[model samples]
Target: MRRNRLLSAVVAVCATSALGFTVPQTAAADPGSTACSQMPSDLRPTLILGDTGPAVRQAQCLSNMWGGEPPKLVLDGIYGTVMLKKIEWIQVCHGIPQSGVIEDHTWEVLYHPALDCYLPYPD
Candidate 1:
C-alpha cells in the first residue's frame, strides 16, 4: 500500500512539475506487468490520441512499465486517451512537456528509462 502511495505521489509530482502545470493527485492509478519488454524496441512513432496500429501498441508497451505498475490496456494498438495520459506521465517524469505527444525527448526517455537527467527540467 505504501508503494502505491509513493508511486501516486511520483506521478502527481512528475505531471505537476512538467511545464508547471498542476495535475490533480487523483490522476494516479494502479496496475502491474508490462508487455512492453516483448514489444518491438525500435518503434518510436509520435503517437497521439485517436491513432492506431502496431505503433500505438508499441507505445502502449513502453508506458505499461512506469510508476507503480503497468496501466491496464488492451494493447490493441489504439492511441486512446488512457495511453495518452500514460505517455504524458512518462514525459513528465523525464521533465518533458506533458503535451501527450511522443517526441524525440520522449523517445530518449523510453529508450533509456534510467537515463538520469536534470531534475525539474525547464519546460
Candidate 2:
C-alpha cells in the first residue's frame, strides 16, 4: 500500500511537471488586486461575444496574466470581438478547441494560465 501511494505521488508530480506548467511571475496578479475583486464572487458563467457582466470582467482580468504580447484586455464588463480572439488564443495555448467561448474548461485555463504559449497571438 505504501509503495502504491509513493508511485501515485511520483506520477502526479511528473505529469504536472512534464506539462510545462509555469505561471509568469511578472504578469501574476497581486493577491488583493485581482480582477475578480471588481465584483462580488459568484460561479463563473459561460460567456460569449455578447455577454456583459462581472464574470466577463473577471475573465478579462485573469486572461491578462497570459503575458502582454497581444496587449492586455481591458477589464470592461462587456465581452466583445477582441475578447473573443484572446479567448481563442488562450484555448489554443492550452491545447483546447478554439471555441472562443468561456465555459468551464476555458475558465480553468484563464484561472491557471501557462507562462509560455508557443503559438503566435492572433492579429
Candidate 3:
C-alpha cells in the first residue's frame, strides 16, 4: 500500500506538471497598438522660423539616439538660423526631405534614430 500510494502521488505530480496552467491573455500584450489613440488628434506643428527651443531639444535627443557625434550647437531652446541649418544638414545626411522644419517625420527620426540605416519616415 505504501509503494502504491507513492507511485500514485508521483503520477499526480507528473500529470499536473505536464498540463501546466497558463494565465489568460489580455489586451496588454500589445501596448503600442493603442498608443497612437492616446495622443492628441489635433496636434499640429507650430514651428517658429528662428525658434530652436523644442526643435533643438529634439535634435539633441535625436543625436543621442543615433549615437552620432555630438552636434556643435548649444541646447538652448532658441531655434535660430544656426539650428535650422544644422537641422537641414542632419536631414540631408539622412536623405530626408530638407524641410528645415522639425515636423512629424523629423521628430520621428529624432526620436527613433535608427542605428543601422537612415529612416526617412518614422516607423
- Backbone clashes for every candidate come to 0, 0, 6
Model 3 has an lDDT value of: 0.52
lDDT of 2 at 114: 82
Which digits, one per residue and each the tens of the lDDT, describe model 2 over residues 5-93? 98997887788789976435434544334535755434668988999988898888887777758778898888999899999998998
RMSD of candidates 1 onward, in order: 11.9, 8.0, 15.3
TM-score of each prediction: 0.56, 0.70, 0.45
Candidate 3 local lDDT, 55-91, one digit each (tens): 4544543433333443455556567776676566566
**Sorted by lDDT, highest first, which candidate order results?**
2, 1, 3
Report RMSD for candidate 1. 11.9
Please report, as a residue range, the 10-residue window in candidate 2 with the lowest summed lDDT: 26-35
lDDT of 3 at 62: 41
Global local distance difference test of model 1: 0.62
Better of 1 and 2 by lDDT: 2
Q: Evaluate residue 98 in candidate 2 and report its C-alpha lDDT on the 0 to 100 scale.
A: 92
lDDT string, candidate 1, 94-121, tens digits: 6788898877787656655633323332
Segments of candidate 2 deviating more than 4 angstroms: 1-23, 26-35, 39-42
Task: Give each model's whole-structure lDDT.
Answer: 0.62, 0.78, 0.52
User: Which consecutive 10 residues in model 3 have the weakest lDDT in total?
Assistant: 22-31
The residue-level lDDT of candidate 2 at 46 comes to 90
